[model samples]
Target: MGRLNTLDDWLNYQENLHFQDINLGLERVKKVYQRLFPKGVSFKVISVAGTNGKGSTVAFIGSIYQQSNFKVAQFSSPHILKYNERFVINSVQATDEQICHAFEKIESFRGETSLTYFEFSTLAALIIFELEKVDIAVLEVGLGGRLDSVNMVDNDVSVITNIDIDHVDYLGNTRELIGLEKAGIMRKNTPCICADTNPPASISQYAHQIKAQLEFVREKYASDIGLIGKHQQQNAATAMLAVQKLNKILPVNTIQIKAGIKYAQLDARFQIKTINNKTVILDVAHNAAAVKVLSAELAKQQCSTIAIFSALKDKNISLMINEISMIINQWLLVPLDVNRAINMKALSNEFNLNHNIHVCNDMQNAINRALNDKQYQRVVIFGSFHVVADALKILIPFMKNNEEEIL
Candidate 1:
C-alpha cells in the first residue's frame, strides 16, 4: 500500500476510524498492537500518564536520554502546534514522510481490528521508534491509562504526574478515582513514580497491587527547581527523582541528568515574552486545578493582568473563572474553533464575576485588544490549548515583525 501524501489525506483517513467515545476496554487495541508488534518489544519504553504535566515530564526524560548520547524517541498527545509534534526522535520531529510511512505500515498490520485515532497514532509512533532503533522511547498516555493504547507496551519506568478532577465523565469525578485510572500504567516489578504532593489513596494502592516499586515526591526524594510556581517545581522534582531511579536501571549518568534538567523546553507553560514593549504570557490552563496555578503565577508577576481566555465545554469554567477573577483587570474571551470548545456566551455567563469581560470571536482581535491596552503591563493568553495555539500563531509573527523593525 502507498503512503498518505497530503495533510487532507491523513486527516480523512483519521476521520474514517469512527471511534468517538473514550473506550476503557483495551482488548481490541491490544489484539491489534500484539499482532503488529509482538510481546517483549524492541525498544525500552517509559510510559507517562496523568491529568496534567505528562507532556512536560516526557520531554524532560527524552531530553536527558538524548543528552546521555542515547537515541531517544518520544510520543506525546494533543499537539499544541503541529501533528508532527506528537513524534520526536533525538530532539527532532519525525518528517511527514516518516509519519506517513509508519501510518501505512500500521494500516496494513491492523487487519480487522478497529483502532481509535489516538490508538492508530500510537501504533505508528511505536513502529517508527522500533525502526529507528531508539535506546529509549517515552510515551504519554492520551487519556486514562488502563485502556490508553500507549499502556499496551510494558513500560520500563512508569511516571504518573499530578492527578486532578478533569475528565470526570470517563475517569470518574473524584481525585482518587482519576488517580487510579492514571496509575493503571504501572507494571509489575517496574519502578513507578508519583509527583503529586497529596496523591490520591488509590494511586498508592494501585502501585502496591501491581507490585511496582512506588517512588513518591517529598518522600523518596526531593529538589528545589528554579521554576516560578510550586506545581512546576514539584513536577521538575518528580521528573528529577524518576531520572535518578532510572539511572540505576538504565545506563544514564549524572551529567546527562544535570544537562536534561537545565535544558528542557516546553512552550506555553507560563511562558513570558516581550513583543512591541508589551509583556505577554501564554499558558494552557483549561481546568480549575490548572487555573489555580495560573492564578498564583499571575499574582506573583508585577503588573495589572489583562486575560485573553478560552476554554473547552467540559471544563469547570466557573471554578476556573472564580480562581483568577480577582487578579484580572480585563477579560477578552475568544472562541476556539474546535468541536470541544465552549461557546463564548456560555463561558461569559458562567463567569458572571464582577469584572469587565468582552467576547471576541476572532483570536487576533482579542490579542490585539489585549496588547493595545497600554495600562495593563501583563497580558495573559490562557485557557484551552486551541486558544493558546491560536494566540501563539499570531504572537510569533507579531514578534518577528517587531524584531525585524528593530534591526
Candidate 2:
C-alpha cells in the first residue's frame, strides 16, 4: 500500500474500505487487528460506553489526566467540526498529516485482511497511542460496548455514562437490554463506573458477574458542576468518581480533577455564546432523554426561547417534539442533508405544530432568521450533530464579524 499525502486521499481511501453495519459483532475485525497489531494488548486503555455523555466524559478524563502530566491519547467518534477532532493527544487534535500517516501504516499492515472504516480508524489510533508511549488512552465506544471494536483492548477502567433508547434496533427496546450491551466493556476485576443515577439492573448484575468493582454516581461520589442542566451534574459526578477511583492506582491529583471538571468545555452540550448582544445556546439533544434535560434547563432561564431543531429519521422525532413543544415559542425545523435525516414535512405532520413551527430547508437560513428575530431573547440550536455543525459555521462567522466591527 502507498502512503497517503493529503487528507482527502486518506478520507477517500477510508470511504472505499469495507462497509459499516451498526451491530454487536467483532470476530472478523478482532482477527484482523490481532494479526496486524498483536501487541495492542499491552497498552493501557480506558473504554467509555453509553448512549449519551460519552464524549464529554472522555474529555473530562483526558483533561484531568493531562493536567497531571501524563502522556494521554483520546479517541472519540462522529466529529462535529473536523475529522482530526476524533483523535487527540495531550488535549490537542492530531494534525491531518499525522492521522494520514497512521492510516497509511494501518492500510499496509492489514495486507489481505479487510477492515471496516471504524475498525481501521480505531487500529490507527491505537498504533499512534502505542508509538507515542502514552501513559493512558481513553477510547469512546462508537456503539454497544460488548462487541464494539474498541472493546478489543483490555481497559483498566470501563465507564458507562447513561443508558437510553437511541439505538433500539441494534441494542434493544428497553433500557435493561441496552444496559447489558454496554456493560460488555467491563473486564474481570476491573473498576467500572456507572454514571447513570438510576442504572438498569442488568448493568449492576453484569458488573457483579465479572467481579468488577462497580461504583455508582450517587453512591460513590457526589459532585456540584458549574455547568447548567441536571444531567450535566450526573456526568460530572460520574467523572469525579471515576477519577477518584483512578487516583487510587494512577497518580491523578485532586487539584487536577477539580480544575479539569470546572473548566471542561465540550462544544455542543449546553454551550452558551453571546452573538451580537443576543444569547445562543447549542446542545446536541437528539434523543428523548436529552430533550427532557434541555427542557428543564430552558425552564430555569428567564428569556423567550426559540428552538432551531433537526433530527435523524431513526430518532424518536415525535417524542422529542412533544417534549419541547410547550417550552419553545417557535420551532425552526431545518432539514439535514444526510441519508438518515428526517424531513421537515414528516416532522410537521407527525407533531401537528403548524401554527408555531416554520420549515426551512437550509440550516444557515434557519439560523439567520432565528438570530435576526428580536421577539425571542434566547436562541437554542439543538437536535442532531449536523444541525449544530451548520449552526456553528454560521454563528462563529457572525460573532466574529460583530466583534471585528466593534473593534
Candidate 3:
C-alpha cells in the first residue's frame, strides 16, 4: 500500500482506514468533499434511497439520460462484480487509472479526518463526475440516507422506491423509522417522489417539515419492461416521475422515457441465462422483501428449480428463506467467506426440517451439483450480492460462448 498506485491497492487501504465498516455520518465526507469541490458539483444529481429497487431506479434514470444523448454518471453501492461497477459514466465503468487518481486526490485532501470505505468511494464518484463534466449523476444511497456520505451533496431530485423491514440495526425495525431515514435525501423545495403506494407517515411528515415537493405516486408504469417482476413497473414509474419533475432542466420525451424504462437492466436482479443446457436465474434477494418479489417471479417458471443461496447474518434469513421456499424445489446452501456472512452450520440448521437442503463445499460445488441434478431443470442463484458475484465469476467465462439473455 506504499503509494496506492492501483485501484485495488487504494480500495484495500480504504477498507482499513476507518474503524467501522459503516460509519453513517457525513461530517468527515463533507470536509473532504468541500476540499475536492468548494463550489459543489456543477451537474444535476438525483439521489435514490430505499431497501430495494435503488439500483434499478438508478439504472432507469441513467439509461434514460444516456439514451437522450446526455452524458450521465451513475454511482451505486456494493457492486456485485467489481469496484469499477460502482462508477459508470455513459454506461462505461471508470478506468482503473482514473479511479486511482481520484483516490489519491481524496487521500491528499482528507488529511487527518477519517472516512469510511463507502465514504471514499462516494467521494471518488463525485470527483469523477465533476472531472467528466457529466450532464447528470444518479447516486444510489449506500445505506440509510440521512447520514449516508452520498447525502452530503444537495441533489436536484430524490426518489424513495419502497420502505421495508431491512437494515434494522441502523435504520430501525419499523417501516416508519426506515421511511424517515430514506426520506432524508429530500431537500427543501426539491421534488421527492415516494413510489411506495402505502408509504409510512414518517416520510410525509419529514417531507412536509422540510417543505419538499413530495409526490406519492401509487400507479405503476403501464408498459412492458425489460426487467422482470411487477416491482420493476413500480420502479419504472418512480424513475419516470423523477424525470418528469426535472423537465425544465433535463427534458426527455415520452419515447425516450419509455425506451429507457424498457431497456434498463441491472446485473443479478432476476437476470436469466442459459448455461450448459440448463436455465439459470440470478437475483440479489438478500432480504425478505426482495425475496418475496423474487419468489413471485420464480413462480411463473414451470420448471423445477434449485436455489444456490447464502446471506449475511444481519439479514432476516429465516424470512428470506421462507419467502422463496415454496418456489424453489431444492436448496444448495453455499458458504460465503465474508466476515458478516452467516455461519454455514447455523444456516444449514435453519433448513434442518427441509430434506431437500444440501450443504455444498463451495460456490463452484453448489453450481456443479445444481446443474448436474437431473430432477431440477432450473438453477437459481440468489440471496446476497456476494453470492451472485461468486456465481458470476464462475459463470461469466463459462457463458462467453453460450447465448445469454436478460429477463
Candidate 4:
C-alpha cells in the first residue's frame, strides 16, 4: 500500500499478501525469480537443508569463506531480532533501505502471481546477492527442500546437515520420508554432503537413484570450536566437507578453516551470557532431537539448572520436556507472542505432574523467577526461537558479561 517505504511496512504487506504463511512450492517463486534474473545468479551457490543445524552450517561456511578473503552472502530464515538478520552480506546485515528497495522490486515483478512471506524473503536475498555480485552465496532452506523457495536456485554444492523427525506435517512423519524431502536439493553429478552420523536409507537411496555424490561425516573434525557441545563439531565438520568439495575453486586453507570455526558466532545456539548476576543459556531447541543435544550439554554443566521453556503448537512439547526433565530442576513456562505459540493451559498440561513448575506471567517474569531462586546455579532459556528472542530483548540490556561457551 502507498509504495511501502519502511522495512516494517513491506514486511507487513508481504505477511498479508499471501493466503498461507508456509506455501511450500517453488513454481511461484521460480516465476518471480525468472522475471527478476532471467540469466540467473553468477555467484557460486551452497544450499544447506536440514531440521536443526542448517543455520550453524551456513554460518561456518560463510565464516570460512570470509576468512579466505572471498565476498560471501548468507541467506537464512526466521531472524531472532529483526528481518534484516535474514539477509547478510560479508558478515553485515542488509539495511532497511536495501530491504525496502528489494521488496519494491519484487512487488513490481510479481504481476498476478502470489508469493508466500518466506518466498518473498528468499527472492529478496537472491536479488541482493546478485546486485552486490557476491563471490559465493550460502542459503539455508526455510522448510522442506523439495518444494522450498530456496530450491529455485540450483546449488553448486548441496548440504543436508542432519535429518530428524521435524516438520512432520509438511515433510512427513518418518525420517525416511523426511530424508527424501531434504534430498531434493541435491543435483545429479553434484557433491552432496550429509552430516548425519546415521542417515536414513532413503537419503542414500535417493542419492543412488539420482547419482548425486553423497558423502557422510564418517569422521568428525578433530578441532575445538567456538560453539559449545560435541554436536557442533559435526556441524563444523559438515561445513568443512562442503568447503573441501569446492576447494579447487574457493581454495580455503587449513588455517582458514580452523580460524573460521573458532570465530564463527550464531546467537541462541546454546549461547551463554551473564545477565543481572545470573548465568543464562539460550538455545533454540524446539524439536525433540535438538532438545536431546541441549540436554547432553546441560548434563555436563553439573550444576543445578532451571529451564524457561515454551514451544509452538505443532512441536512435541512432551518429548522435548522429557529429554531434559532429569537435568532441569525447575520449569518456568511462558507463552510467546505469536499465533503458533502454544497457550498457557496446554503448556501447563505438559508439566502437570512436575512438582517444581512455575507458569510465569511472561518471559521477563520467568527470568526474574529463575534468577531470584537461589537453588538454581544456571537459568536455561530454550524452546523456540520466539522464546529465545523474547528472553534476549529483556536480558541483553542487563547483560554484564558475555561468557565463553567452551566444552
lDDT of 2 by residue, 1-407 (tens): 36667987777777666665343578877876786677765556789999988978887887778778778888998788788888888878888877887877776677776677778778878877877888889899998889898998888889999999887878889999999999999999988988887789999999889898888777433454545566766777677777677665577777888777766667788888777577888888889888888888888867788889889988888888778777888888888887788777787776673548888868888888888899998898998888898888877877767643210
Q: How accurate is candidate 3 locally (lDDT)?
A: 0.90
Candidate 4 CA-lDDT value: 0.90
Tell me the TM-score of each prediction against the true structure: 0.94, 0.93, 0.98, 0.97
Q: Root-mean-square deviation of each candidate, in angstroms?
A: 2.7, 2.7, 1.2, 1.5
In the range 1-407, model 1's lDDT, one tens digit per residue, is 33678755875677666567456668877887888877656877888898878877887787778778778898997888888889999889988888888877777787877777787788889888888988789899988898788888998888998888998888999998899889899999988988887899998898888798998878422343323455666667667777777675467776777677567777787777887687788888878888988898778756788999989898888888889888898999888888788887788888655779899969989988888888888888888888889988888887777733210
Expressed as tens digits, the lDDT of each residue in 1-407 for candidate 4 is: 56676888888888899998988888888999999989899899999999889989999999999888889999998999888999999899999888888888998999999998899999999988988989999999999899999999999999999899988999999999999999999999999999988899999999999999999988877787877778989999999999999999889999999999998989999888775556789999989999999999888768888889899999988999888899988899998999899999998888857548879899878888887888888999999999999988887767735444333
Per-residue lDDT of 1-407 in model 3, one digit per residue for the tens? 38766787888898898899988877888999999899999999999999899999999998888779788999998998889999999899999998998988898899999999899899999989999999999999999899999999999999999999998999999999999999999999999988988899999999999999999887889986877888888999999999999889889999999998888878888888988788999898889999999999888867798999999999888888888888888899999989899988989877747648988889999998887888888999999999999999988877897866743
Preferred candidate (TM-score higher): 1 or 3: 3
lDDT of each: 0.81, 0.81, 0.90, 0.90
Give the runs in model 3 whose Cα sits over 4 Å from its true position. Answer: 404-407
Lowest summed lDDT window (length 10), candidate 4:
398-407
Please report, as a residue range, the 10-residue window in candidate 3 with the lowest summed lDDT: 398-407
* Model 1 stretches astray by more than 4 angstroms: 1-3, 219-228, 403-407
What is residue 319's positional error in candidate 4, in angstroms?
A: 0.4
